[model samples]
Target: MNLALHSVSYAGVWPGQERLSLEEFIPRAAALGFKGVMLVAKRPHLSLLDYPSHQPEKRQALRALLAEHDLSVHSLAGYNDFTVGPERPDVPFWEHQIVYIAELAALAHDLDCPAIRIFTGYNRDGLSYDAGWTSVVTGLQEAARLVADFGVVLTVQNHHDIAVDYESMYQLLSEVDHPNCRAAFDAWSPAVQGLHGNELAAAVRRMAPFTAYTTVADYVALPRYRYEPALVNYVEEPARMLGVPLGEGLIDYGTFFDTLIETGYTGTVAYEMCSSLRDGGNLDSLDAYARQFQDYMSPYVAKANAGVAAATAR
Candidate 1:
């Protein structure tokens, strides 16, 4: 498995820190020892509208930058929500997203990226469970078809509301039915969902065949407290998750990665600092965390590479 740094780590969307441009981010990722990068297809990075089909110069510039940094374009992540606006026939949000995905697919092909990342929609009001599910399937199918022409696959990350768990993700990928549609399965969601040991391993095995990539991040839940006037006591609110270095968090990446490596996952393992961190989101902090991730993931990367090597020898 190749190690890639997702641009969102420094994009600063969550913590309100200043975002880094792709020009600055590419070299930083390479400096942090990332072999490749997953560029967020949004502002402060590479948006679809900014790098349209007609803009060969923009693509060329990005390619040149990647070469200068000695980095590869692992994937382009598109922000999508297919569940909302399910009842609005007059609105064109869904159509625009499909077109945007197709555009991103073209850009991925131009940059020699094999995959594009997307999210399923969050379950919102005005949409029934069954209706929301059908919408996701249809949207992904269309997106898959659009990208398939470029030989680019759509890897659905488990960040969204639909198809987050192992069983649902497998079912979603199977239902999409497009050869280009696959899962970007992550350990965080399954870990948070309470899967562990053989159960988690079995889930990983089930999604292994359809999984082309996985995003990794570690987090620890911070307990929250709220004052209650009626009871004259402080009530415990839900714990807020804060990002931390790999081994310091609650995620069981040891078992998670062991299962994936043994299953012969020859895909990219992306490290992301997506939430509020233990330290602030400054470049110094980001760089430190990023380097820590590479160090933490070294053994797993070795394991995955050895698995590939053994399979090839066979």
Candidate 2:
């Protein structure tokens, strides 16, 4: 399986430092042996918000940038309709969201990205769980329909709140019930929602036919202190981010990789971390930070390859 870097690790870095352009990040990721970058296609970076659609000049510029650094776009984060937190669905806004997804679909097609990432959203306040779930599914289905003609797949991430559990995820995917609709499984969400590990693994296998991508990271429960340690202290008040350093984190990397092998997953295995996005992580030094990340991941990948070799020998 290929390994890729998701730009979310550098979530708060400004335009000048990390990933405002391919030049800022591609070479660094390449040197660390990452296969590609999960470009979010957002503002101040690619300014994807303003990129002229289907424009020849812009397409040529993008292609040239990728070629310059021996890199390619893995998938755009395209975080649309993700956390529509517990609000009753708006018919008009929902229709507008469809148009937004269609534009993103067109852009994905132009960039040659095979899949788009979406998030199963939240329950509307005071709305019954049944109605909220139905609306979320219908919204995603509309996005699915727009991209089906181009053979592009929509891979939804298992963020909690909306997709709070494995069973809930199954329900969402069932609603969108199309082959091109699929899962982008995050390692810890199933466990967060209290599913048995085996059951969670089984849920992944069920998504196998439709799982286009898989994101990996370990989570650590907070130390029982009065207040949390500062991961992004520079933010003055940071969000309660839990995971850090591949093996050091709570999620089991070794077991998770074993599961990936069992499922025969061959797509990109992406490294996603939000802890290092802060002011003092020294990540912009590039080689230092990315190499540290590579070091953490290298052994896991090697172990996986050895397992494959052993199986092939049989």
Candidate 3:
């Protein structure tokens, strides 16, 4: 398996694009030994959201920058139109959501992204679990099938909001029922539902058979999970968020990595650490923190690589 990173780790540095263009992020990531960079497909690039102007120029520059930096575009972090609420006979909610999803699927295909990350549709408004899940599964299945011919994979990711747990994620993938549509296991997100290492393991095992890719980040246990809905829905600062340092966080990475091995999962494990100060007291802290994280996880990653080599050798 290969190790990569989501360049969004440096989100703080993005607003200062003039000071540091997208090209700057590639070398920074490459220097950290990242095998690839998963760039966000938000307005700055393509998509209906925020591609104000110079969008075409920005897209070309991104491609050139990747070539110049010798980096591969592992995935597109599109964060598409996967949402949830109760279904209704009169409401156009479900139809609108599905149409939005199909449009995003075509956009993903046009950008040449092999995979696009989506969240499970769940709304807290008014509905039973069954109703919400059914709507989610139906929407995802139809949309995933729609994009299958384009060779694009619709991967349901474990985002914080409404992502129930291991069982739910497993079920959603199964319900999709298309070979090209698969799961992108974002393991740490389950902690939001208060599951432990063993429970997480079981979910991973269940999802593995259908998993096409995986995203990883260290989940730091917080003092208390506050309900901060405004920003990232994170309750408080110093919260138990993912994307901290490799081993310092609460996630049982040893178990997670072993589970990946046991499941025979052969895909890139991208380092998705997005912590603000966890990199260090400053933005420039990435260099030092990246080295330490690589050093800390090296033994396990090396062994994982060795196992792959031995198997490939045969």
Each prediction's number of clashing residue pairs: 0, 4, 5
Expressed as tens digits, the lDDT of each residue in 184-279 for candidate 2 is 877676655554457666766666666778776655565333433575333233224454556665555565566777777667777766454322
TM-score of candidate 2 versus the correct structure, residues matched by position: 0.80
TM-score of each: 0.96, 0.80, 0.78
Give residue 97's lDDT in candidate 2 (0 to 100): 61
Query: What C-alpha lDDT, on a 0 to 100 scale, does residue 47 get in candidate 2?
Result: 46
Instruction: Judging by lDDT against the true structure, name the best candidate.
Output: 1
- Please tell me which model should have the higher TM-score, number 1 or number 2: 1
Choose 1 or 3, whichever is better by TM-score. 1
Cα RMSD to native, each candidate? Answer: 1.3, 5.5, 5.8
Could you tell which candidate, 1 or 3, scores higher by lDDT? Answer: 1
Clashes of 2: 4
Instruction: Estimate, for each residue in 1-314, the C-alpha lDDT of model 3 and write its tens digit.
Output: 66666666655533331222355668888777776767655533345554323355555655666677777776766554344434455666767765655655555554456776666765656776666677677877887777676677777777734445667677677776777677778667665565557876777788788777777766565475667657867554654453466777677767777887778776767765455444353445656655666677677677777888888899
lDDT of 3 at 17: 18
Q: What overall lDDT goes with each candidate model?
A: 0.88, 0.66, 0.64
**For model 1, the run of ten residues with the poorest summed lDDT:** 10-19
Runs off by more than 4 Å, candidate 1:
16-18
List where candidate 2 sits over 4 angstroms from the true fold: 13-22, 82-91, 194-200, 224-239, 276-280, 284-289, 299-314
